[model samples]
Target: MTLAPAPKPAVAPPSPHPRRWAGLAVLSASLLLVVMDMTILNVALPAVSADLRPGAVELLWMVDVYSLVVSGLLVTVSALGDRWGRKRTLLTGFTIFGLASTAVLWAGSPGEVIAVRALLGVGGAMIMPSTLSMIRTLFTDARERATALGVWSAMASLGAALGPILGGLLLEHFSWHAAFLVNVPVMVVAIVAGLLLLPESRNPAPGRWDAFGTVLSIAGMVALVYSIKQFGKEGAAGPGPWIALAVAAVTLTWFVRRCLGRPDPLLEVRLFRSRPFTAGTLVAVTTSIAMAAVMLLMAQWMQLVQGHSPLETGMRLLPTALGALLMSPPAPWLAARFGTRPVLAGGLAVSGLGLGLLPAVPATYPWIALSLFLLGLGMGSLAIASVAIMAGTPPQKAGSAAAIEETSYELGGALGVAVLGSLAAVVYRGALPPAPAGGGLPGPAADAVRESLGGALEVARQAGAAGAELARQAKAAFTTSLEVTGLAGGLLMLAAALAVWWLVPRDLDVTASHH
Candidate 1:
């Protein structure tokens, strides 16, 4: 026999244990809960307004405060996770979030609700970054990591899609309080599972928590988000919004300079030097802006305009969820074959197409399912592209990378709702004639009518024939405004798609690049 070559050293096989997967399951469940809560309460806004009697500004705050705080704190909390063990930080966050949910349920005033929502945001900041960081630690094998991330992404998308359904069910059967109360059971389960299953992990070079950076980040984000919100309410050129934006710019500039000088910064500004990373971040931001506004508008149309019960409205959205579910499983395969850039660009175009179709959906259109399915399919593709980008990032910097990605998501969403929602409000007001001075309306009711479409409708419903005519006119105006808003959102998505085509490389494999 030909001198047998020395047997090659055997390579060790991967671990067969299920514990690692269980850890991911626990983390994914926690993430699902956090993301679901972000939008579930939206469907219940009408109920909240009816019970809490919030002003227009207060109503906007109730919807946006959680996002603002979460976005502001993400970079800081993500840094904290690098210093402390990710598991410990995540568990602590879960506890805080659960308790805050209870507080939200019991909140008697709009201000109290806003405060609790902000607290929930703090917890969310800790939780979001930790989940992605833990996933990085749990799966060392590249292929396994991709699969795990796919599952996690699917759950996140599902949770967002399901929020309206769950909220609608709760509102139809119980009260608006039930929307928040629902989080309690989910959180309790997630916390228990996390403690039992999660393995602790931390960065080897965990740096000091930058307190000053934290303050600057929070202040800058709050000012920026608040300014955008104000711009939506008062227009972008308004003096008040302009002032807020200027403050935000100054604070952010200072924060960036401070980070550049620090040896170990809270947010590593160097990350953006990577073209792929920067492009990915831009894609995430624009995709969120494109989709979030549509979700908000659709919810309003289903509940306030069409008079559909919350449960019924949610049921109608089932097609969108189904489409997303179907799309998620194939994401990894598509990325592997086509490469991330092409897949991402294609997805953006598809999403833009779907959004463009929305403006054509007639009031009496019976094909709601088709419209939602198309939208979901497009968005689902974009979601996979985002995951691909994150997974491609360096392991050591996963937390910061995740924070950046999430911040873009949150900021984009806030801007979308503020800008698109404001545009719709302006058009609605312009189309409707002013209410009569003494049309048997109370001062508060008349004032509210001037401010909110929903409030105006409620007033009309309760005030008799004259009020009914006013309601009719207002409804027509609202519909027209929604159509215009949808067109604007569609055009923005188209622009984003073009941006992706121009910026992202055509043949780049995100997975291979990182490896």
Candidate 2:
């Protein structure tokens, strides 16, 4: 009996990293600022335009370049992080971000600003995936990982809620440069804290760096995003956008094939073969598509139509964050009770209901607040989606999973703004009553008015008392566009919900090790 050696006492699993929670704080705080950069820039753009007087093309580049650079570099950077230590990559990103922010002091021209933005994008690309991958490293237990992800998801909502308020406060006291400058101190702290708390992690067996694959990825991403932007600006009538799209299609296809053929690819394209990974990715993409256009429109409406100050608009947006905060922390618990499939699909349904309410309910602030709240509540399911993604992946592949998730968000947002934004523009133009025959506003002013809601408001300001009716009609038309866009987004959400229900396995257990 003694010879059996007591069956080796069923060795217990390893405990989680000692400093994981503290490390999570650093990662979440950094993520908060990264997300904040997007919304804060939106608030500061008017001030920047007034000071710099950038031409239309220059301004567009200023905005689009950051995302373009981020999208292009994400795959390569994420893979690099897997080979070169994730902690080292993240700390380097912080240094780059801090330095780039400091550069704003000397960035007097739009071109300089664009350069700074591109650099920040590089930093952001380095930072974003590393946070998720590190989370996967820090929390080995599946349930604990899910909780950490909830916190991670909630930080994004909090950052969005805070950006406008913070930006507004800064702008009132300082110049638009303050927005960029604000990143320096935060990045400094992140770098210091990350060095102390975050553990080094890498794929121990990561093979050859795919240099050609990197080129193909960067080219494909840039062309793809550029085509979407062009189509948004010029619609489907332009050959340039079509050419870009064709190039993107061919290059991306080649990239995918190359990845599949390699013993060690730049990205694990085969991750899509896993049901949970694909389902989780679909949720992320669809949620982003529904969220982006609506949030953009809402910000404009609150500021231009309702005449709210930037701070007020930011405060109004707080309900969405509040809803997310209330629901996100408990999402894993809910999933434990109901299972991942129901929780995820049900969340999408709830979000769809919220979006549908935008058109169905009265177009008042209170009703809008309610809709936003519901949207946030439903979006809490993203924590579970993330759990599914990371849990299903092998530990060595965490970087790839994180990159795919982040890329889904970026691409989905771009698609949302381009496709739904174009739809809104058409609706707005059609909804606007044409200027009275020949006796109405001058041709240039009329054209400006028809160009966008902002243009209409600006022209109205110049016209003074005579432009009241023009302003009124423009506001109404913009409202109509918002409602129509909301309806379309809601329908898309419902369709996604149905797809998720079918795709996610009913008996899937996120807590159990899958790989």
Candidate 3:
């Protein structure tokens, strides 16, 4: 035995698998599908509305239900992925997405389409978490991980930009059904490729999946988002929204308390003890807040104000997406060279300056394009924000960290739409010169004109010269609102940059293992 032991020679342990890059491609495709679905409907809404003929409330639900479902389930599905397998969860999500997207072919009614979208949301919830968590596992090196996340962020930017373009093209040739159908082919490829290329990864010692925490998280997020949506549309006049907000507050607070008390929490709240994590979360929140509502308003401006077709609108928006596509991939390299604090803060400042210029852009088309390009360039720093998030989290908590970052984004967007939209509405309403006393507009039509620029345009078309004048008035008011919104958004970006600069540590290494 002693002789045998002496004869034993050292042998090297196996190296990490070499297929991570291929796995990333698969994950990026899935993420694109999820994100593209969110924006595809924007350009298709009119077509869908014409076909489905859903009522006002139903139309809103159709547009918003997907986001609500996606936001509500992100945390629950992420935890489930850890308890099960990340790759398994991702595949299951892809299956659900494919089947549901295919089911869209059968959807005839508004309710059915909403149901399909909700199901897609369920699939999205499952897919999103798995992608980020798997990336953390696939790329063990920090530099590699940062690059992977850059690609990940680029896909997201590309997806959001891609949706409207693809939808516009599809709607030009086919029915609204083509929008959902497009998801099926991409998903089928994703599913097959995923099974072959994506390796299985999960928490080696993931404790119990907290059922209560899941319920709390889902309910709280859903209620919060619903309330925000209601506020955006109807403001705080209703007790319903306020009550929902209260419930969200209570449930989320209790959920947080439970997380803190547990030895192994569903979400690792304590990880936020690190400066980088907190700063990253803040960046996610602020950037989303500054961008989401403005983009929505701009889209309306392009179509309702400028009278552009959906295809034209998509084309006009291309500069923003192109800028993001160009910037996000290189963001990691820039951060690696200059450090995250400067890049992230500088990006925010640049974004802010770009946004500030939005209010001053001449109404001409070329100026608008220039403003959008600069805005995209500024927002591209989002790639660095993602790096900050993963750098601060331990590998074991990748799913949790991803869930939190996503939650911030979702909620921030909701808040942005609700809060800033309300502001725009206020400005629009205020700027509306008392209906030209002699515009010959009906009392009901006059009320409609006051509601929104779109309403004004429709009323104007029917009211003759007076209607034309009213359309001009409404448009001018809308333009003012946009200018105000742009300035507000700019200020927010600048503030975020300053805050991020202060929040991130000077020497934080995002590429290093948190463990």
How many collisions per candidate? 0, 0, 1
Using TM-score as the measure, what is the rank order of every candidate, best first? 2, 3, 1
C-alpha TM-scores of all predictions: 0.89, 0.97, 0.95
Question: Candidate 1 regions off by >4 Å?
Answer: 1-18, 52-58, 104-106, 236-238, 430-452, 466-469, 513-515
- lDDT for each residue of candidate 1 in 1-515, tens digit (9 for 90 to 100): 68988999877744533688999889888888887888688777779899999997889888888888888888888888877888899998998898998987669999998898888888899998899878877876655666666677677778887888788778878978888888888888888899899888777886677788889988998889889878877776669989889989998899989888887888877777766677778777877786687777776777787888767777776666676677766766677787766666676666666666665877653655676676667666665555655665666677778788888888888788788888878887777676543366778987777677788888887887778677777677777777777678767777776776676667666545232
Candidate 2's displacement at residue 476, Å, is 0.5
The better candidate by lDDT, 1 or 3, is 3
Q: Per-residue lDDT of 287-332 in model 2, one digit per residue for the tens?
A: 8888889999999999999999998899898888888888888988
What local distance difference test score does each model get? 0.77, 0.90, 0.85
Question: What is candidate 3's local distance difference test score?
Answer: 0.85
Largest lDDT belongs to which candidate? Answer: 2
Ranking by lDDT: 2, 3, 1
| Cα error, candidate 2, residue 4 (Å) | 5.4
Error of 1 at 475 (Å): 2.6
Off by more than 4 A, model 3:
1-16, 437-439, 512-515
